[model samples]
Target: MGNKRICVPNKKEAPLFSWPWEDLNNYKYLLYGPLVSKVLYSIYKEEINNVDTWCLHILTLFVLRAFVHQLWIIYSNMLFLNRTRRINQQGVEFNQIDAEWHWDNFLILQAIVASLIYLSFPSLANLPIWDFRGILCCLVLHIGISEPLYYWIHRLLHCATLFQQYHWLHHSSKVTSSFTAGHATFLEHLLLCIVVGIPILGTAFIGYGSISLMYSYLLVFDFLRCLGHSNFEVIPYKLFEDVPLLKHVIYTPTYHSLHHADMATNFCLFMPLYDKLWKTINTRSWDLQNEISSRTKSRVPDFVFLAHGVDIISSLHAPFVLRSFSSIPFSIKPFLFPLWPFTFMTILVMWAQSKTFLYSFYNLRGRLHQTWAVPRLGFQYFLPFAAEGINNHIEDAILTADKLGVKVISLAALNKNEALNGGGTLFVNKHPNLKVRVVHGNTLTAAVILHEIPQNVDEVFLTGATSKLGRAIALYLAQRNVKVLMLTPSTERFIKIQKEAPLDYQHNLVQVTKYQAAKHCKTWIIGKWTTPREQYYAPSGTHFHQFVVPPIIPFRRDCTYGKLAAMKLPDDVEGLGSCEYTMGRGVVHACHAGGVVHFLEGWKHHEVGAINVDQIDVVWKAALKHGLNPL
Candidate 1:
């Protein structure tokens, strides 16, 4: 039988459900703000030899814990690695992630308690910086007292009454991340603080404690906790083969995952010795760990949606970071402001590296699909000299996908800009014999926009009329006998698109030079970004439909603004933990769905260069048939 899945039992929120600053949202960080300020002010006052070290130590520990968790998250989610080693294949959705947003609140609570302890016992202050005796005392006390204490308390929490009241929250995440280690009720975390404190306080009260001992012990505890919950198996089984007794000395991620999967077994903190003594260790732990770690290669994706980063701040909205933030439409938030400098540094690092990296992936109808990101930022694409560099990234991604047996690769956002690479025409023409189909996916994009326009509307104002999508839209509408007021400064370009229509229906396409000509028009198709001044020309009831990247600001409150063309994915999609940019769960941009439809239909042709007006309806029909509903 396949690995048995244990469902988390339904439970109400624990009685002690709320965090200190639960409603503060991002401002929750302000709780520790005074502590941080104390550190800086103490340093500025040249008081390093004084009590400032306590705050410094706590701050450093918090940073280190967060770093370790993030490092494990990145490692576990990496697509290029051997994914067969992944323990829990089920995805963590947005709701579960949002519930876990306060995972680190336990650290903040513990730090506050530590501060109170330091104040209560003045003897704990200004301890020696190094003490070899204290280190040994910490290790001894932790293994003897903390490990067994934690194991028993953990088992107790699993008992029906406490499990339903508190522990169920921790077990709720079917696919555990590093943060999963801390996602517990306040009561459980309170118990954890006591379990952790006994080791350090035991050393301190015995006159053996030191700064190094405290820091090292707690940090090691955090590191091991994160490792155990980090769903992917990183520990090698050969170590156990070399030293057979070591399996009881320490626990593996696979061992811990079994606890989540079966619930009644493997209830140890860091050592399996306790579980073995209690006979709670799972029978399949060793076999499964070896099975996963023995694999060398990751599965290949059938399709790749080549996406690019939008901006520095939004970069943190990936599956690895603020997952709660990424699950919804991306917007600038105050909490993200503090992270701008760090994200800016990351941008510098990405600029130096010139490889496409896997961002996220999911399974659709048993076919593996992945999204790869070009390291360049959104604004970088607009730079005059940056075109070649951007194209090089796209070409490299396409060639790499071709080599990896990726059947189709779609260009998203500005990656297929005409000015950048002729809507991906440059690569196809340059390579000439590529096995992988390069799709701009604009046919479905155009179809989504066209369908959004009401059929009863006879006249429409079209901006960016000479552009790829705009041109196709103009031709399609004119052929259907809808009067299209094509707005462009270039009369030559407008006429070129006008002639594409049949000779009988060419009059339906009108060349207009100013937004004033569209004052009487209610249906506005905006392929170009419309400014507030330009938007003012539309009548009060005008509905603005756009295919513009970044989307235009809704300046006219009186008018209704339609979102960018997008489609909801089929219900059968699996492991879709991350949202597609701003789109909600199971929803993706139309171009992304276009690529999915392209793969589903098993088309042999590449959808590059320009859109085929004839295939607009055909691609749209295929998308709907494949369960992609337009949003």
Candidate 2:
């Protein structure tokens, strides 16, 4: 049982020893606000009086540790940076991601402890800022005392009783991120403080301590700890080959990854020398690191879903920022309040670049699937000056996907805007012989909206009646003898769509200019963004089924609102660690699912230009047959 891996739930029974404020959730960070304020005041006091730098040094060290850990987090999630070099190929699920949300709690605990230490010990206070001799003393103490002490304690924790109660929390994450290094129970972290403090305090007891030693020792300790849990192999294998003995002295990300996978081996903190002396090292660590490093080519996916940022804030919902945030349906949170300025700066930087970046990927049915993003946000698609730039990025993505031999590339959200590039028709027309199939996937989007209406309903009100999806929906319903109240101001566009229906059904399609015409209509299909005043025209119990981007708000309590069209992926899908915007786990927008269905059916023709109204039921049935359930 000690060697077995445990899968913790996102919200589960509290382990034996939990953090004091674990119940606070996101607000737990507020617990350290007082200490942070004190640290800031200490900096001001030090500059004015030159009295002591103890509090200032602690603050600087804590900030440095956080910066290093955050850097690793960003680097690990960059899929464009040689994904094959990642140590763990298995995706991290929401359960593990959510559990690690309080990873920085350890640092907060340490800051409070340091404040107490300063108050109690006067001899160690007001020390000089630099001492070269103290650095040598610190290293000696760490190797002689801290290293051996931590190794034995770690091994003891692996015993059955302790493993089940405490150590299991740290090992719960099979796929490690930099934050995983600090993801442990209160007891474990408290013990870690002792192991970390021994070297610093020992140097002070010997009269060799200085502020430089404190910063250097703690920073290196944090840098190495974060490096081991980074889930990406950064330390080159040639270094171990050149030094020979360095393999036993330092641990790599792959070495620590093996320990998480198999709990019985490689049980050392940062250094592999202890594991080697105790015969606990995993035998496969060295060979595996070299194997992952030697991979020169990246995996080419079978299908690609080209997505774009919905807004300035929601754009940070990528896998790298916070998996837990991205895994759930997005909403404005108090925690994100301070990040707006930084996110705005990032948007400005993205606007200057014209590259399509890889966002996330997974494996399904022996084929690789990927999601790529055109660096433009949803609002940018509307600006007249930005249209040409947006189209160029989309075109670049298509040409690149074709070069990589991707079978299908689906344009999603604003990437397929009819006004911008005629639903991706511009690309297909430019490159007539391209192997990759460019798909707007609007057929599936229309099918999802159409099938949602109750079969018993005879008359339905439609908005954006002249649009691609609206036109298809109107003609399809008219052929079934169901009257469609098409809402449009253009008579020529409405006449063109109505004539496509049979003569017997042409009279069933009626064009109405105002929302008042739908006051008596019970079912409303929204293809455009609607205002609350317009929504007031519908009666109680009217359900608004929409294909609009960023979905409209439900202003009326008496009426019902349907989310944007989406489909749940098949259960057999593997490595789907991230959620599509505002969708739950394993759910994707209907257009994205359309591309998957197109690939699975081996369809050859381009799904770009205008959607085929006849293929609506065909694509819907195929999706259902392949286990894509409508949401």
Candidate 3:
């Protein structure tokens, strides 16, 4: 939520649900309870005949719930849409969306589901609407009977073979949309219906259930599912807190979201009790739910976005060979190192690795003074022969973050190039056990780099001009009417970039294919440098900014770069003292800063593909405020 200072209990001791009355601040949300009751009462009126009413009511049940679901969404959005995203998951909340597909699917299934279970005669109107015993019995019978069946059946579907063939579709939207609730395979959909059908239909034949109770249960059931998928949590949690046991008996929207987010956990549908008993509950679900339930109109959002730096293999050769060689009992082998055999071996390793980069990640815990972690994904180097390995490294890096429970992650450089799904559809499709969200942090990086440019710089020289980030920056400068000197190894690529530049800024280009064209420029951007070291050079006197991780800082040893500055902990980070990092700050790469900015801004869904000019302005403003835009 955009709110600041919302109190969240320490996760270690936090309960699954908070006490509602204790939340006096959000007690206003409880006001909607009566509104909910009033609307539901009107929808579930006394029926004329039990038989026709059962059929009519069964169909009416879905529509009534759909109406309530939509109304709840609109009502919640009116007050808390921007303040909170979804029912319980953190970061930016979604706007009211068309969940017609969810509605349509249910409608499509309504007739089939009704006929299959003989939903023709509901219990008569003899049972009072306020008959508390009848309602409690209905609620419990459903929970007791349906959830255990749903749990085991659900768990069975997760068996490796079945999951890939059947369940992946339902798990597709880790971040649920309304349709997400209805997005499972038709078989899965039928099973969902059967779970509830047993309770509603069983009451009709048993002679004690009422149309009111059936619809009420059905209505509440739909509302909860929609609530689980809507991505917003408006229930005053303290109500459950006051009734302590209600927490275990009820499931919140966040609880269900955890199921979709990370499969293989939270198997029970109605409540987590079965999940708890079966030990199938996700470890992080409760604490995360409490974190969301604890939100108020005051409190900064606490979402962590992870990122990583990747380098072309050639760049790491100098470091990898230097380190590996040094690590070898160098003191004992000092004489050997200078000899022909050792020297020849070192050069050979560097040569072979010149094409591929190493595979590893470094944790950046305290550098940003916020909860941001980046695992710079790298590979052994380029083997024009084995590019697939690099792709695997990126995949491995993503799985690493997801398994660790990161909520959102940003892909940089080649990682962005390889995994820039319009909505992360690819990763969602490929990684079934996936949980973490992905963002191409290109937007904020665009913002920071643009901010780093000194006002005196007019003409810009950009290298690797055809790369994803490079292309974005080039277009942005063109949009701003700034002249650019484009240099890349490919003439075709440079020309393509020139054509892509807006017509108004076409004359602003000093387009050149030769590397020498970058000479004498006031501003230079080493845009994801991928060229061999011997072929790349920076203009010594110009203000140069490198955006890649482990930056091309040594393009020229004598050229000055931003001095690495150490961060002062706890004091700079508002008492989060456990964060560990040696103080250092020169220019942290723009990609890392991009991840940090998303964490600070509470933007969980601000997934950028190619950072646009507008995003640059937003991030630039934030970077300046934080003093992270070092030139």
Q: Candidate 2: list runs displaced more than 4 Å.
A: 1-16, 33-64, 241-245, 262-264
Candidate 2 lDDT, 1-631, residue by residue in tens: 0111244456454454677776776687676576567667766666532223555566677788888888788778888774878887766766666677778888887877777787788667766778778888888999888998999899899998787778888887767888899888888888989999999988888888987788788888988998899877888888988998988889998898888888889888877999989999899999998877677777789999999998988987888776657777777888887888998898788677767888998788989889999888888899999999989999999999999999999999789999999988999999999999999889999999888888888999999888888999999999878999999999999999988988999999999999999999879999899999999999898999999887999999999999999999998888777789888889999999999999989999999877788899999999999999987
Q: What TM-score does each of the candidates earn? A: 0.89, 0.90, 0.38
**Cand. 3 TM to true fold:** 0.38
C-alpha lDDT score of every prediction, in listed order? 0.85, 0.85, 0.53
Cα lDDT for residue 569, candidate 2: 92
lDDT per residue, candidate 3, 1-631, as tens digits? 1121122244222231222232343343343344345445555764344344344554566567667655554433332133443343222111111112232354446545564445343224343444445566776668778878888989998998667666665664434544456655556766777887777656655655665777688777777777667666655566766786766677777777777766778877767789889888888766676667677542222233332323322222221232222112112233333454654554456445433222212223333222332222344223444445545555665676566565566654445553334333356568756656566666666655665666656788877566666777788887777787777667677777778776778777666766666656647677654344522445666556655543554555545543211112111332121111111322234554566566556565546444556567876666556655444
For model 2, the local distance difference test gives 0.85
TM-score of 2: 0.90
Q: Residue-pair clashes per candidate, as listed?
A: 0, 0, 36
Q: RMSD of model 2, in Å?
A: 3.9
Question: For model 1, how does the per-residue alpha-carbon lDDT over 1-631 read when each residue is reduced to its tens digit?
Answer: 1111122456445567556566676577788887899889887987774467777888888888778777777677665453667777656665566667767888888888888887788668768888888888888998999999999999999999888777777887768888788887677888889999998999989989888888888888888999999878888999899999989998899999999889999999999999889999899989988887776756788999999988888787877666656666777789899989988887788789888888888888889899999998889999999888899999999999999899999999799999889988999999989999999899999999999998898999999888999999999999999999999999888888878889999999999999999998889999898899999999999999999988899989899998888999998888787777777778888888888899999998888877899999999999989898977
Sorted on TM-score, highest at the top, how do the candidates line up? 2, 1, 3
Q: In candidate 3, which residue ranges exceed 4 Å CA deviation?
A: 1-55, 75-103, 116-136, 235-242, 296-631
